[model samples]
Target: MYGIKTRLCLSVLFALTLISPAWAQTFDFGEIKSPILFQGNYKYAYRDPAVVYHEGKFHLYFTLVEKAKDKGMYWYTAQSVSEDLVHWTYPKIITPCDRNLNYSSPGNIVRKDGQWIMCLQTYPTPNKERFGNKDSRVWIMRSEDLENWSEPELLKVKGNDVVVEDMGRMIDPYLLEDADEPGKWWCYYKQNGVSMSYSYDLKNWTYAGNAHSGENVTVIRQNGEYVLLHSPRNGIGVKRSKTPQEWGEDEALLTLGQKDWPWAKRRLTAATVVDLTKEKRFGKYIMFFHGSPVNPKNPRSDAHNKASLAIAWSDDLKTWTWPGKNSQPK
Candidate 1:
């Protein structure tokens, strides 16, 4: 009994509902437990978390340190798998510490041509001096499954002998597939300020230049734009760019001592931001970072030691909420 004009209007409304994209389910920030992953006994601590969702599970790789007198300081990549980001199962070391080298800052894990690749930074062990470009370099390994890995090999540039230039030291290498330029990859690392390099093979890189000024850089693509997150001055900041080479400006996102989150009170560093747009359980951006406590005796020196892994969630990649009762951003 409907008129022709009424039927046409109803048909249009039905078409619009079918074509419009479904909005992702909102995640409750209160459900996430703080210090999602940590280490306590045996003088062991976690730092530099690198996260990737693979095979329906979240794999978290991070720098595991052991402070012992006989062994001295050792750094290796340890892994944990979680079906739901809330609970995790600790696995054996993914990348073992070399006797003569310190394997630190596990980078991105990308699957290409049915093979898995993991990149990390390395420096000679037992060196009490600060890390220099001469001693530091990025190395890579390949795996069929996520468990066993090939021997670590130095990542060399096309013409240059070093991965990064010798004048500036580099660490915390994060790999991203260059969206603007197809078939190319971008590696962003800390060299004075966030430095960049381009590669086609992922092993042979060409040093580009400094993209911006930040450390522990993690880049993600959101809504066709690239966002870079880094830790500077014991806080988390963000930079945006349409192209990977030119980051416009910096904005402080999160900071320690601003909120009463106990785990992140002293310092917040080595952040890894995971984009969960297509994820089933939680379709929001999740940031995992290392937090440390201020040494009551030597606050300045001990503040940089990252002892635990903390997490925050965001709906729009701008506003974030923590787990605790006083989770309001200051």
Candidate 2:
């Protein structure tokens, strides 16, 4: 009887260990090759990267665009995992297949309650439209494990007073907790130059105002200041502010090796940074951004289909370095 009881206890403890989220575990990111992390082919295009490091593994969520069987393209929120930055698991599409609700562009992931919340946008380009119509809206999805996700729930960031259809076009939703105020959450989306909305719970939101910024905005708090990384015309632009409500000015515009990197010669945008400076093993800020292949004649040719994902790291936000490139900040 005693032996059986001990065996049962051991099994339960082992199971709990596997399910626990381990942020402290350190990893050795062996030799990172060319800055091009994931090379997109003619058929598959990867863009809008959002990353989270949990359980000692890197979870990468991005917009996966594939050519549809009949015509047009399908955008999906897909995920891939990696322990070392060099190798990654096969990507799995987490969203359903619907042209009208082409769910893509996962901005970032946050933990609330007991589940994980991810903010994204619906870029419906049905009928071969260039961009999402007025129906484009921001949303959030819940997940206990990062692998599986629940159906997206509309963010309604325009405020409860406004109707859903009247919210106007919005995309690239990022969630951040107010540093000065606890339990108060902020949702930043791109509408009229990066508008913001706040909510106590993730459900109801009250529209705040807008900031003069570019699209795909990801803000991080460092040393009591909010650091905003955004996409301008062809590169990632940086801005700093005392608070989230307002921004000061552009600190720098980073076009990391775009001239040398033909894969990213066309454009380098949608840059998302994960500051892991506290982690002793990895004491630098890691950034993931997608770049489009260059075309000398058109300069925009193969911009959509052959776009690829890339990585860069920085000790300070001003300077960045990536593998297969010179050590100097570009």
Candidate 3:
């Protein structure tokens, strides 16, 4: 009887630890795997990854592109989970299959008021255009458990007066909390070189400002400073600022081992950083980025398909290392 009671008590404590954020530091997911997160083919391609570590598991969200015989190609916001970073569960599509509403490029996810919110964009290529039409706009969805998300709601990051149709072509929406302010939140998207908007309730937003930056912008607050990572033409670029409103010029452009890796020879972009420096298992900052293979015959195919999701890590956000490399600093 005593052994049974002790075992029950220990199980209850473990369950509580998994749900507590403060206990994340001690959680371990075992050894890391190869840098390739997801491999793409002619049938499917994965891009624009937005990842989060919750309850001792890594939940990765990205844009899943599928090729259809009758419809050509369509995109959906999909998700996959991994416990050890080596093996991942099969991806599950969470959004619709409509080409006009191709809800892809999930920037990132944030938790507010006991709910998880994810920001994304609608890339409408109804006419088989290479890029999204002018009707492209930013949006957000809310979820209670990060599994079942609400319908996509338009994010008037351009403000209430601008109107939805006049928002123009804005994509790659990333959400970040203010470094100094507690309740104030910022949404950074690609427009006039990355525009900024602030929101207090996540529903109503006020246009703040814009800056000269690249696409797929992801920001993190480190050492009392804001570190902004944006994707330039070939690789990911880094910029720094004390505040989100005012950002300095690009400091460094990082293309980690693209020259050596054949899979990333064409391009390496859409990088997202997850700072697990405090955690004992992954004591460095983890970066997940997607790359496209070189296709001389079909150059345009690299943009839509033949792209792959890969991983890399850094100790100081400057020098980097990957799975099979010799820990070369970039």
> lDDT for every model?
0.73, 0.87, 0.87
Worst 10 residues of 3 by lDDT: 22-31
Q: On a 0 to 100 scale, what is the lDDT of residue 135 in model 2? A: 92
List the candidates' TM-scores in order.
0.83, 0.89, 0.89
Writing each residue's lDDT as its tens digit, candidate 1 over 210-256 gives 85566788889988888888888778888887888898678656663
User: What TM-score should be assigned to candidate 1?
Assistant: 0.83
Runs with alpha carbons beyond 4 Å of true place in candidate 2:
1-30, 69-71, 327-330
True-structure RMSD, every candidate: 6.7, 6.2, 4.7
TM-score (C-alpha) between model 3 and the true structure = 0.89
Instruction: Write the residue-wise lDDT of candidate 2 on 1-330 in tens digits.
Output: 459889999999898778855444454444786788788887888999999988678999999998766657888999999876778888899998888999999999999888899999999987866677889999999999998899899998888889988899999999999999988999999988889999999888999899888899999988889999998888999999888888757899999888887778788999999988987657789999999886666765546777799998988888888875665346
TM-score-sorted candidate list, best first: 2, 3, 1
Q: How far is candidate 2 from the true structure (C-alpha RMSD, Å)?
A: 6.2
Q: Candidate 1 at residue 128, lDDT?
A: 44
Expressed as tens digits, the lDDT of each residue in 74-179 for candidate 3 is 8899999976677788999999988798999999999999999999999988876667889889899999988999999999987788878788899999999997
